[model samples]
Target: MFLAFGFVMMLAGFHAESDEEHKVAANTAMVLSGVYAVLILLVYFAQATAVRLDSLGDEALRIIDYKRLGLFFSYDLLGYGVMSLATFFIGLTINAKSRSDKWLKGLLMVHGAFFIGCFLTPMLGVFNSKQSGVDWIGTLILEVWCCYFLPICILSYLHFANKSNK
Candidate 1:
C-alpha cells in the first residue's frame, strides 16, 4: 500500500510539473499522501513488533492491541482518513484529458468522504470493543472502497503511460 501510494504521489508531482496553475494543489496532495504512508507504516511496524513482544506488560499490550478496537486500530483509521484527504487533493490537481482520467478524478475526490466517516466514527465509540457485526460492516465498506479504488489506480497508470508515449 505504501509503494502504491508513493507511485500515486509521483504521478501527482508529475502532473504538477506539467500544469503550473495547480502546482500548489498537487504538491499539497503529495505531502499529505506522504504523511499517510508514514503513519500507516509506523502503525504496521508497531503492530508487528512492539505489540507482539512478550516482555511488554498487560497494560501496554492493551494499548497497542491490534486484535480488537484499541489505540493502534485508531491510528490505522486515522492514517486511512488522512489518505482519503490526500486522494481528494490529488483529484483537485488533475486536469482530466480522457474518460479514464475523468473517472479517476471523480473517484479520488469522492473517496474523501471516507475521511469524514473514519474520523467521526471513532469518536462515537462504537468500535471500542470487538463487535462481530460492526466489524463486518467496516470490513464490507473497505472492500467496497477497494472495488472503487482499484479502477482508479489502473486508469491512473494508463493515463500516465499514454502521456509518456506522447
Candidate 2:
C-alpha cells in the first residue's frame, strides 16, 4: 500500500544519500524495508481477497482472516518488526547536522526497540485481537504507536526539507 511505497522510497533516498562509511548500514536498511513491504503487501492482499470468500475452508480462514487473530496478524507484527530494523539501520546512516536531525536519529534508533515486542509478542498470544475481551488492547496499542510515529514523520519531513535546502 501507500505506506509501504513511501517507506521504500524513503529508504531508497537514504541509501542513495548515505556516506561511504554508512553504505553498509543503508543497504541493510533498504533490504529490510523491502522485506517489510513484501510482508505487509502479502497480508493486505490475503485479507482483502481471501477473507471474503465463502468457499474458504476453516483452516484457510483461520490463517488469513483479519477479523480473526491469526497468521495475518502475526505477519503484520513481523512486517513492522522488519521495519523497525530498517529504521534502526537508517538511523545509523544519519549524520545529525542539527538539533532536529539529532532528535530524528535518536527517535529512529529508539524505535528499533519495537522489534523486540513485535517479534515475540505474537508467539506469546498477548496481542490476539479476537480472543474474547482483549480486542481493545490491539486498538490501544496501535493508537499509542501512531502517537509515537507522528513525531518521526514530522522530523523526517524536516530532514528531507533541510537536505533540499542544502
Candidate 3:
C-alpha cells in the first residue's frame, strides 16, 4: 500500500509546474515511504518471530521486548503523520485547478489528527496495559484512515487527473 501510494505521489509530482517543487515532493514521498515500509516490515518480523518462539517455551516468548516493537510502531505512526502532511502540501500543487481540493484538504486534516492521536495515545499509557483497548482502537484508526481513506484520496486524484487530460 505504501509503495503504491508513494509511487503515485511521485508520478503526480512530475506534473508540478516547477522542477524544484517536483524534485522535493518526489524525493520526500519516496524517502518517507521507504522508511515507513522498512519499519512495518520490522514490526511484522518481530511479531512473527515472537509468535513462533511461543511454541518453544512460554518464557521465551514472554521475553520478547515489546518496547522495541512499540518504538517501531511509534515510528510508523510518525511516518504516516509526516507523509500525510507532505501529501497534503503536494496535493496543493497538483490539485490547484481541481474541484476536489477542498475535500482532499479536509481528508488530509482528519488523517493528520488520527496520526497524531496514534502517536500520543501510547505515550500517555492509554494503551499501557496489554488489556487496554486503546491499542486496538489506535490500530484500527490507523488502518482505516490510511489503508482505506488514503486510497479514496488517490482515486479522487486519479479522477481529476483524467478530467484534466480531457
Candidate 4:
C-alpha cells in the first residue's frame, strides 16, 4: 500500500507545476505512507506477543493488562486516519489540476469516510462487547472498508493519472 502511494506521489511530484508543491507533496506522501507501514508492523508484533483472550480464564482475562492493546488500537486509529486525510488532500490536489477526475475524487472521499468510521467505532464503544458476532462484524467492516475501498481509490487515482498524462 505504501509503495503504491509512494509511486503515485513520485509521479505527481514529477508532474507538479511548482517546485514547492512537488516537494511538499512528495515528502508528505512518503512520510505518511512510512508511518502507516510502521504502524502495521507494530500491529503484527502486538498480535504475536499479546496473550490471546481465549487462552485466559474469565477472571484472568479481566485482569489482563490492556495497555499494549490499547496502544495498538490508538496507533491504528491515528495512522489510518492521518493517511486517509492525506489521501483526501492528494485527491483534491489532483482534482484541482484535472477537473474531469471526478471518479477519483469521489472514491477518495469514500475511502476517507470509511477510515473516519473506523476511527469512530472504538470511541463509540462499538467493539466493547466481546460477542463473536460483533467482533466478526467489526472485522468485516474493516476488511470491506480497507481492502475494497482503498484499492478502488488507488486504482481510480492511477486511472486518472494515466489519462491525464496522455
Candidate 4 TM-score, true structure as reference: 0.58
Native-referenced Cα lDDT, model 4? 0.54
Residue 127 lDDT in model 4? 54
lDDT of 4 by residue, 1-166 (tens): 3444454554455335325545665456556656666666565555555555246555543433333224455556656766665565555445334443566556655555655765676677655545544535535655765675556546655665776899
- Per-prediction count of colliding residue pairs? 0, 0, 0, 0
**Candidate 2 whole-model C-alpha lDDT, 0 to 1:** 0.86
- Per-residue CA lDDT of model 3 for 1-166, tens digit only, reads 4454554555354334425645665555456545555655565566677666656464444334343234545555665565564454444344434556556545544544555665576577554436644436555655676575765457555755766898
- Give the TM-score comparing model 1 with the true structure, all chains together: 0.83
Tell me how far the alpha carbon of residue 16 in candidate 3 is from the true structure, in angstroms, after superposition: 6.8
Which window of ten consecutive residues has the lowest lDDT sum in model 4?
A: 60-69
Ranking by TM-score: 2, 1, 3, 4
TM-score of 3: 0.58
Task: Report the Cα lDDT for residue 82, model 1.
Answer: 81
How well does each candidate superpose onto the true structure, as a TM-score?
0.83, 0.90, 0.58, 0.58
Model 2 stretches astray by more than 4 angstroms:
52-58, 128-131
Q: Say which prediction, candidate 2 or candidate 4, comes out ahead on TM-score.
A: 2
Model 4 residue 141 lDDT score? 52
Candidate 1 or 4, higher TM-score? 1
